[model samples]
Target: MAYELYYWDGIQGRGEFVRLALEEAGAEYIDITRESGRGRGTGAMLAIMQSDGEALPPFAPPFLKDGDLIISHVANILLYLGPKLGLVPDDEALRYVVNGLQLTITDFVAEVHDTHHPIATSLYYEDQKEEAKARSAAFIKERIPKFLGYFEKVLNQNPEGSDYIVGNALTYVDLSLFQIVEGLVYAFPKAMSNYRGSYPLLAALRDRVERRPNITHYLRSDRRLAFNTEGIFRHYPELDIGVS
Candidate 1:
């Protein structure tokens, strides 16, 4: 059976990470929120979220419905899908290691979101512009390098001495990192002007992930959405510290 993914209709948001994994593995799935039917749109996602069943309800979007299980959270959803889609290592220890990498990316994504919505998610970006500028300055100057550099260290220290994050092969973590790099580049182009020189391994991995057969097709197809101000990564020049 095909997987049913629940997420917002517009921005890529956290949902794009899961979408990347499923696409790379060529898994059959339905992006239910984007579908154009009565039972297959955002209402479908709301119904699931508002259900009063005994099962635990997800607090947000980017949840997956597979068989009888409803998995939510980007990392949690990927944790379950990785094994099924052959995007993780067979060794149990290494799988957990990759999971750690994915969780770190989750933290990095949260920080990126805070760059634009520093004060509060409920408030408009305009309302928080001054605070966002201050927060983003610190984020671009510190957090970006800290997070991206950590991933660089991971790629450089891979025991197998491969380009991939975990083993010599691609894992879901690699896909997540690729998505993060893409988002950072889009949201902070001025700040990322030297990304290749600063984080060569991570940069190379992003390029390689882009060229993967399935990913290449997906990027060229309409299924892929462009990064926008509405998403976690928003481009606001004044917020960035620029290339230092």
Candidate 2:
């Protein structure tokens, strides 16, 4: 059965990570939120999330429904999809490691969202302009290095002697990390200007993931959504430093 991915209609946001895995696996799936006409739209997604029929209702977007199984959370969704897509290893221990990495990416994504909506998501970015600037400055200067540095260390310490995040082969975590780096670079080009040489392993991984036939095609295709202010990786000039 084809997977049903429920996420926001327009933006890539957190859903792009799942899309990358699906595309790479050549899996059959429908982006339910983006599909318009005849009961297929954002309303369909809301229906699923709001359904009381299910014992467990998803609290947010980007949930995946496969057959009777519904998985929520980016990390949880990937954890379920990983082995099915061959984006993770068969080894149980390794899967746990990948889960940890994916959760880290989730944390990083939250911080990225906070950079734009530093004070509150209920308020507009313009409302917290000054706070966002301060938060983003610290994010660009301190948090970026801390998070990126941690990933760099992981790549450097990989016993497989390969650049892949979990195993010698590419896993879903690697794909998710690629999306994180891609969004961050797009959202903060100036801060990430030195990302390549500084974090060579992660940079190389991003390059490799981008060159993958399916991912490359997906990125260039209309199916792929562009990054925008409405999404997690908003490119506000003032939110960034150095290069304007």
Best by TM-score: 1
Residues 1-244 of candidate 2: C-alpha lDDT, one tens digit per residue: 8899999977999999899999999999999878888777999989888888979889998899999888999999999999899988778999999999999999999999999898889999889999999999999988999999999999988888657987789999889889999999899888888899789999999999999999999999999988988999999987878522
Worst 10 residues of 1 by lDDT: 235-244
Model 1 residue 186 CA deviation in Å: 0.6
**Could you tell me the lDDT of residue 99 within candidate 1?**
86
lDDT of 1 by residue, 1-244 (tens): 9999999988999999999999999999999988978699998889889999737888999999998889999999999998999999999999999888889989898999998898889999999999998899899898998999899998999898748999888999999989998998888898998999999999999999999999999999899999999998899888766765
What is the TM-score (0 to 1) of candidate 1?
A: 0.98
Off by over 4 Å in 2: none
| Per-residue error (Å), model 1, residue 118 | 0.9
TM-scores, all candidates, are 0.98, 0.97
Clashes by residue pair, model 1: none
